[model samples]
Target: MPLQFQDRVVLITGAGSGIGRATAVKMASLGASLALCDINYDNLESTSKLCGATTPKHLDDVDVSSNQEVRKFVDATATKLGRIDHVFNCAGVNPTSIPLEDTTDEYWDKLVNTNLKGVFNVTRAAIPHLKSGASIVNVSSISGLRGSAQQAVYCTTKYGLIGFSKCMALELGPRGIRTNVVCPGYIDTPTNAGIVKGGEAVERMVNGNALGRLGTPEDVADVVAFLFGEESRYMNGSVVEIDGGIKGTVLGGQERAKL
Candidate 1:
């Protein structure tokens, strides 16, 4: 039988585009009711339409970095959807990469607050409303598992997510709630548009990965769905890497080139 979410109530942050949007569409197709939010109203509306959700209560313009806004959104989702069975904490930002010395306080603050603190705010607020069998899937990056060049702030935030999710997993486990983090590599999303347009850079990235191609939002969404379902019932406090084996052989590529 196919995986199904017949009556599940799912709350997805960053549901405007990319993986979040894909997940929303996928879950909706599987019969899950969605409460989606993003900072971009236009994109959020587009996603809602794509999911065929016409109700105003199903969508919101929420900045995950703000505790008050997150609280309001979560409260509204619970009020509208009744209860949240799964949460996809996918709202995040990726500023231009620069060397550590060149990084500004403003840039660092923006990334940290949105990426790290954002996840915390949403998850913290939703915890009280999450049912016993609830699942929380946080979207980290391959940079979280391993450092990247000229991405000190971004890496820091991603790494923080891993630790934060692990702690939540442990604490929520006793209550039958599961928390897991997904680390994706070079996914073909708006955030990586620059690299995708840079012909040679894109090739280099593909060559670095064992799969020999960039991942699509759907690839990650499938895994997110798995983690949210009963198949992953025992998968608490786990860090799943959906990087197409890039992390395993990234350094090996350098060694081979040196040879």
Candidate 2:
């Protein structure tokens, strides 16, 4: 049977683009109503349009890093949408990579605040409103599992998110609330567009993945949908990897051979 989300109220951050937008559209199609928030109002509007007639309550210019903003959004979502059955914590930023020596305090804070603290803010605010059987899916990265050359700050934030999600799962499990994180590798999202724009870079990314292709936003969205629904009712505190076997290759040093 197809996974169904009839009447579910889903709260999604970063719904302006990439995995967040894709998930919103997917859930909308599955009959779930949406409450979408994004720092980019224009992009968020575009995403809402793509939701195909289901008017999602939009909170624009919501910086997830701000607890106040996050709380306001969550409160509005619950008050407007009724209840938040699922939360997709997908609002994150990937700045250009810099070496530790070159990294500035501002850069570190930006990544940590947006990537790690943002998750905390959103989840914290939504928890009080999330009823039993609710699900929270956080968008971590393959970098969360392993370190990259010049991504010390980014890695730290992602790794911290994993730990945070696990703890949330344990604490919330008794309440019938599930918390899980998704780790995607080399997704062809706008966030990574600059890195993969060159043919050579694109080839390297493809060859690095055992699937021989980068993942699409929909690819990650499908997993998010599963985690949000009864299909993954038994899943909690799970760290799902949607990396197309990249974890095995990258961590096992198989990618070294290709280089």
Candidate 3:
């Protein structure tokens, strides 16, 4: 049986890499039409080439942090695609994980604007055109639910995304729109490749989680695909955790196992 989503118009921001790239390709594989936008034109085109070749319909270079740009992109998407049915608010950033004292004004502003305000801008712009029964998936992070030792700004932004998703669901569910958040744990993507490849961090991360393996972009994409369905029809304002069972594991610093 077809996994549905055939011919559905799905909009995904940050369609360049990590979960966003994976989701765009996944939806297209299942036959969904796409409206992709990103700040990086090359990466966006890479995702476009990987999609179902339904003529793309829309490809926008948008600074998602700005409401005006986001609104324009959304308007263009609906105008070009005729309507939008699903939106994956997946644009985000990872600031240097350093001590709070080391964080600067520019760093905080940049992180929040891209990671938090970006989500808000896209969702707000798309709300009017989101058809009834449509779904909106916000890409949050494990840091949103828990603390990260050196990622305060990043954590704060993701945590804010979770809150935004909840409030969005409350306001939009009445109109048959569903909003939800997905918090991914240590996904091994190009975005996090630097940290994941470090010898010490890699060994420790492996032993710390139940799965004993880092998450792939596709692992998160699978959950996103499920949430975009009737299986998750009743799941609104919900926070779906995709943390490799790390949330339930005991918290501590343990010696890394020899690989």
Candidate 4:
């Protein structure tokens, strides 16, 4: 049977852009009732329109780092939508590359709060509303799997998410709720516009992937949708990579370029 989410309610963070926005549109097309939020109200509104939501009461400006805001939004979604069947934790901040020695306390706190604590706040608040078969997908990055220079704090938060999701899976699996993670590598999103604006940086990334192309938001969204459906009901605490085969290339960078 084809995948369908009719009458299901899905709450999506970072619904303003990139993978989150793409997922919102995809789920809406599949007949899901959506509740979306983002720090940017304008972009959030645009995403709501794309989803064709008639009323946007459950959608608003929400800073995921704030527990109070997260709790309020979660309650509103449960109250307005009658239930929350799935949660897509896609809200996160792009990391600024800087040497470890130059990393400021302020910058570290910013990344930790949004990338790590934000997921905590949402999951904590939504746990009460979620019932059997509910799925929670947290977005991490390829940086979580391995180390990268000048990305200490970013890697920390992403790596923490993997651990956190696994724990949630163990705790909630008995209750029939599944938790999972998606790690995307070099996706061509607006958040990475500067890096992909046309230069050696973009070319290097394209070559790094075995598929020889950067992943798109839709690419990740399709996988997210599958995880939410029954096709992946047995999947829990799984860390899925949506990077166009970046994890499979065995050749050195110089040698791989020849292919």
Per-residue error for 176 in candidate 3, Å, reads 0.6
Candidate 3: stretches off by over 4 Å? 1-3, 193-197, 247-259
Local distance difference test, each candidate = 0.82, 0.83, 0.80, 0.84
lDDT, residue 191, model 1 = 57
- For model 4 the local lDDT of residue 152 reads 83
Residues 1-259, candidate 4, lDDT per residue (tens digit)? 3438987899999999999999998888888888899999899889888888553336889999999999999999998889999999999987766788999999999999999999999999999999999999999888778776677888899999999999999999999999999998777776674354558767877887889887788889989999999999999999998777785432221211100
Which residue pairs show backbone clashes in model 4?
Answer: none
TM-score of 4: 0.92
Q: Which stretches of candidate 1 lie over 4 Å from their true place?
A: 1-3, 53-57, 247-259
- Compose the digit string of candidate 3's lDDT tens values, residues 157-236: 88899999999999999999999999887677775643545687666666567888877889988899998987899999
- True-structure RMSD, every candidate: 4.4, 3.8, 3.8, 4.2
Off by over 4 Å in 4: 1-3, 53-57, 193-196, 247-259
TM-score of each candidate?
Answer: 0.92, 0.92, 0.91, 0.92
Residue 183 local lDDT, model 2: 91
Candidate 2 regions off by >4 Å?
A: 1-3, 194-196, 247-259
Candidate 1, residues 120-143: lDDT per residue as tens digits? 999999999887899999988877
